[model samples]
Target: MIMAWWQILLLTCLAFWMIIDQITVGILCNYPLLIGFVAGIIMNDVKTGLVVGATLQLMVLGVGTYGGASMPDFMTGAIVGTAYAVMTGKGGDFAIGLAVPVGLLMVQLDVLARFLNVFLLHRVDHFIKLNDTKQAARNVVYGVFPWGLSRAIPVFIMLIVGEKFIRQVLAVTPQWLTTGLKVSGGILPIVGIAILLRYLPTKRFITFLIVGFIAAAYLKIPMLGVALLGFAMAIFYYQKTIKSSEDHESNSTVNNANGKEYENDKGEYEN
Candidate 1:
């Protein structure tokens, strides 16, 4: 399964599925973590897959698309990253270095894909105007082709380029640059987190942030434990807030009833 055509085909199909799934079924197949896990399974290196995939996941933590905007193609990048990380055995750092640029490059391809979709939409409109339902439906379905191919073609080409090409590139790359890439890879998550915090209600939830930090740093709690702790805190706050709202509402209702029964200045009941 490692670096073979079938593996390449599977990875390419996964890339195709990632985009289409995002637009359609949305089973979270577009996430880097899942992409890496699947890529790792195909490459027979689940541990490496998780590491590389998780790293990429961190890199896109706060990244999202609004309106018609497209972000980096980290999902496809995860597929390449995991596959190459497994094949090269050069560690996740080196794989991270390779994966990121591919993501950036995909921004342009994403635009191209969107443009192609626009063209197809026009074709669909043309058919619709002519009252050709089948042609219009066919053109509508044809929109899948651009998006699917956008990721699939690059992934197939990258995978089929073989391990030899990657090794050869690595052989010529400077040691300092390679080390830098490793360091940069580790720092990427911090950048993502910084971006996320900037957009979040950090001041209001600063208590939770400090608690999470203490749990991870001082308590040395595992991520799952910290996550569970967060869940517990969320539930407590949610219930407390809901109860406060309900109590306020009840008090208001009682006040309104008393007001309704009270005598006005004219000695008449007023609502």
Candidate 2:
């Protein structure tokens, strides 16, 4: 399949995303956009791809890195979701909405993949213990190849078989249910934000986040503008807080020394 011109290009990009997603561990791989855009190019439907990509982007806007853990298996969602969405003759909000649940379902499968990868590591370690370098290399290759195949095969199968099932499921699902999923899709980023909040030590940063939300909600400020303002505010707030702390420390030290010196002078005078 990779030999065909368009399929080759798509697979190359897919492979690139897979490699990068593993290396950066998903932090750097924006798979949704890549999948939608590349699939769009292959299918000659760039606008639909962009719309789907942008919509999915917003749906995941609140996702973040937490304690070295990624939000979910975005690559699976990207590849499978894009393929399914495009194949279903849907675009824009509908396609994006469809992709959201597909992405969510893939998370569990991703955990399974992680568990299997861990087992592979143990097997690799066993080879290393025997001083079998070639075996170790083979073990690593075998381990990594399955990980790639696990992702690629399921996605390929979904593209061929799962798309129709998804369409039927969506057809049967009530309007309200789909709408709820869309709403959840928009709000699910909060889970990521909450994960990020664990690292926040000061209330001031929380206040800024609230302010940004208010600006975007009430003031009708653009999201990008609000994000930029929030970033600037966070920087300034932390800098000022740090400076104030240093100044307070210096003042405390100076005052303590002055009190000790005054006590010594009084003792000298009394003596």
User: Best candidate per lDDT, number?
Assistant: 1
TM-score of 1: 0.93
Which pairs of residues clash in candidate 2, taking residues 3 or more apart in a chain or in different chains?
A: none
Show where candidate 2 strays beyond 4 Å.
Answer: 1-20, 23-71, 85-89, 111-119, 161-184, 190-206
Q: Please give, for residues 106-182, the per-residue lDDT of candidate 2 as tens digits.
A: 56655665677787789889989999889888877666654565566655655544445776887999999877755
Model 1, backbone clash pairs (residues 3+ apart or across chains), number: 0
The global C-alpha lDDT for each of the candidates, from Candidate 1 onward, is 0.89, 0.63
Best by TM-score: 1
In model 2, where is the ten-residue run with the lowest total lDDT? 1-10
- Global local distance difference test of model 1: 0.89
Q: How accurate locally is residue 21 in candidate 1, as Cα lDDT from 0 to 100?
A: 95
